[model samples]
Target: MSESVIGQVATTATSQARADVIDGFLGTTRRYTTSSAEGLKQAWDECDLIISHLALGATTRLIAGLLVNKKTDPGVVVVDEAGRFVVPLVGGHVGGANELARKVAEGLGATAVLTTATDALGLPGLDTLGWDTSGDLAGVTRAVIDQRPVALVREHPWPLPALPSNVTEPGVERVERRGTHVKVLPPPADPQARILLSDSTAVPDDLPTVVLHPKSLVIGMGCNRGTSVAALRELLDATLGVHGLAKSSIGVLTSVDAKADEEGLIELAAELGVDFVTYPAAELAEYQVPNPSAHAEDAVGTSSVSEASVLAHGAGLIVEKTKTPEATIAIGRTEPRGRLAIVGLGPGAADLLTPRARKVLSESAVVIGYRPYVAQIRSILRPGTEIVSTGMGTEDMRTALAIEKAREGRNVAIVCG
Candidate 1:
């Protein structure tokens, strides 16, 4: 390993040892003293990172030492003497140990090994390791925490050999393998790890890690004071689908003024198998689009319908409109993507103006509405906001443009005359 190719081996070896290892591995690297422990300790403290040769005795012991003993937080890793295995000894997730392991394995011509369920089970990575005393992690119907063979229902990466039935459970559809160590998703080409399972539902309770399916989130919403649930749901759906998401991802529902108690929204959520959540009109009001219409006596607040979306994003829940034949079921925020806010700028000019609507327009990235409507905020367009001006046209064209902009994950303003 020439110093240049190996990038000058860094370590804390009385300066002499550091030079020795650099020269040894570089020029004529040699170990005159039989001090593996001393060298390793120095390597541990000297260089910022230490590389382990694959499941070899030294690497295994190093992993055990780091995890069981919690020595210095070195980036311990195992690679074959031939540069195979390349397993991250510690800090596999945030620290990039998992990624390093792959590189080492690749350097040694070994297969990359991953143990996460999403990778092992062959699903897109969306696992989590969290405590939900409220039991509201992510619409979890059935989740086994940090499972070994991950008693899971969904299938992820196909194992080298087919997974054992015991590896996963029947009812355990959602599986999350939790721990201090984070799991990495291998590229599609190389997924060759085994799935492990345990008879006990409880893992040893290490630092927790969780894995889960990438289901779209759903939120059932309820409103009041002449609010129509159907229009709300439609708005949410149209808005959500525009963003290339689905209805099934909803983990929970949200409504205005603690509308969680509202019967129509509640029933609708139950029908969809999602939880109903009602937030304060004030809270949901944060998402409300500014209503220029407020200046008018008839104008209410900014299109709070649009403001509701802020709740979904802030709540970590996607907003879905509940089913309702009466009220406008304008649900569309509950996409795998973020929520959609649709502002119905009230009838005309400065007469109906509200601070809330102004705030939304100010924050919107893509304002979708008639030329005049978007033109109303001549001075407000931020440099980043992409205003999509629908030409003077019919409701169909205007509606279409608003939906398109919202789906594109842009804050949309529907200036209906």
Candidate 2:
């Protein structure tokens, strides 16, 4: 199980001791003596889970107006001063408060008060179905809990577990034609409200849709050594827009290995919130491409950087190379690798590290950091693990290396002090 950074708040010393007991059990816990609004605010921002040794109402009031979304908010658990009941006061499902409450209750021998309907009825909510999914989560979940019929449409052959009886496919018995529907396909012509699951850049602008981008697009480029990020951004936006693609669908930005340290490409990828990867020119030259350039081959030892790099990663080119004054860009769609965990290990002390941090480190094929930080976790790494470390003043180099490894479908952990 992944451990959590728990924040404990209490008013009195006795309450603090009780909270400390729960903290010790959870590990990675910090105690806050001040129950003031400011302290609660700081905890809300810093911790993954917050346990307040106060009444439910008081806890709710302290965190008032700070709630963002189910995806980003911290799980809030409230325990009565007497420690009789552990209640998940907010972020019960998506933020993992319900699970945290159960763990706390089990540790303290208290009752866990859960009120989420899916948990109560022992059925998985439609919203709980993982992936980069977006839609009428509340509407579909409500329909499922009330046993109303729902339509599920999928374009790709993604393996979904057995859904509840209330949720059915397009052609099932007693299927509701006019009720809420979930679609896991490309944008349809109809402009009706529905949940959309797609990684394609093209989506129906006319529909009341919830778009789920699966991070399937890869952008390949070759640019002048000092090309400005603005120029790259303009070209990228135009290219993607011309192809009717969504920016969020992009998974990574790629280029020739020589451009690995190209500041413009790196900055653009960072601004787009995607990984940047580079392949050697000799490696890229091996891939057959539609537009082989003699000039490119003479310059970079590859006939084509934009097209060959895309195909080198086992992706089919969607848009052929489009050129700007000093840059060439191409787009490709590939099978999704999907997820990455970027963890921060504060202070480098064993006691200070969270269980989740350790779990991530043990599971990673590549452990990267400053040399001293890598040495701190040297004993716990699995056999045959790849350790990539750089000396001081090389933080960006190590980070880029870690991202490159992850882009190649390896779990990577970067430890920091």
Candidate 3:
């Protein structure tokens, strides 16, 4: 669900005005104001964040026993009657309460009381390091804040942000393994206060470890004609289970060009919420794979459909070809690619353009547009922005170039008038 912000107000002129101001700042579609405590509780259950224009004591008493863990609870920010201070009452980092308090304080011209140590010390919390993570966040964060030694182990050299000085990889410096540590293994046999970055579904039973699922796996498939979707899905699920791989990590489903029209393969990819890609048979034949079948070579002009198709993208093979009666599947891991945002710069006017459109333009590595449209937002473009332009008559060429740039793993923006 999309994150929603709500303003909880009491029956007072000042509270109502403050709520209205907050609603205006956050946008009306997903922001609301409620007068009753019952309404606030309902909003709390439905929304991801709540800004209460009430006394901190009253707000605490209202949500007293219902407060849950930092990971699951909604972010709660309490604003005083005078709007002098914005205090995050619960779910500071993981639930984004601390960040929300800062934003709310900025909008209100008030002070934000942030009690989290990492935020004060300019260090990032371990839980907030990756896309999807869950584990003993509180323990590890506390350990890091207290300047204790922690271990970092990674299965793959996935690109990550620079960790704090206290967190180090094993064998870097001889430090006692006495405090909370972080590990990026699949599933450690003995668990401690550790953080794990893995796409494996198998979790440790005893240790308090955070598991982060990076979108690293790609599945390549080749199926016989007229195969049923149910059979293919079952085989794919079993294969992932046997390898301790998470379905969430599958970035794309790939195959040879011969199976592009296969409905079963397409449906499987759609159900898994990943893109389906096809390579030419000749292209797939260029890669050397462990298993080469003579029958597959005669049938599709590629000796190894699944492995070769995955390796054709320069990905590392993690799983060999496993087959069913009508299907064959392989898995590979690859680094994530950049996304493309096709935006329209409206009316060639800065005032007419939306803030989101401007932000996309600034974030884009390559901006493609007609010459006149590119000139409109030229001042706002960031440094190193590659501008690709065409004349007014060549809209098709602009679109094709934008698509090619995106396919090459660049964040592109196609601006239209």
Residue 116 displacement in candidate 3 (angstroms): 3.2
Least well predicted 10-residue stretch by lDDT in candidate 2: 173-182
Full-model lDDT, candidate 2: 0.73
Residues 233-296, model 1: lDDT tens digits: 5655665565544454445555554444566666556665665655554455456333212321
Q: Candidate 3 on 1-417: residue-level lDDT in tens?
A: 134554454557787787777767766523334544775687678777777777899888888776877678888888899998999998787778887888778778899998888766655555554356656666766765665655565554443433555555554332221112323333222323455667787656454555667778889889899998898899999999998898877778999999999999999988977788999999998898998888788888999889998898667898999998798999999964556677887677875788688657755667777777888887777543657766767788777877776765557888876
TM-score of 2: 0.62
Which ranges in model 2 have alpha carbons more than 4 Å from their true place?
Answer: 1-6, 10-31, 47-49, 68-73, 79-86, 93-112, 123-135, 171-195, 201-210, 336-417
Query: Which scores higher on TM-score, 1 or 3?
Result: 3
Error of 2 at 333 (Å): 2.7
Backbone clash pairs for candidate 2 read 201-245, 201-246
List residue ranges in candidate 3 displaced over 4 A.
1-13, 23-25, 29-34, 65-70, 134-136, 171-196, 200-211, 220-237, 246-314, 323-328, 336-417
Which candidate would rank higher by lDDT, 1 or 3?
3
RMSD of each: 22.2, 15.0, 12.5
Q: Candidate 2 clash total?
A: 2
**Model 3 poorest ten-residue lDDT run:** 173-182
| Residue 355, candidate 1: C-alpha displacement in angstroms | 49
Residue 283 alpha-carbon offset, candidate 3, angstroms? 8.6
Model 1 per-residue lDDT at 10: 24
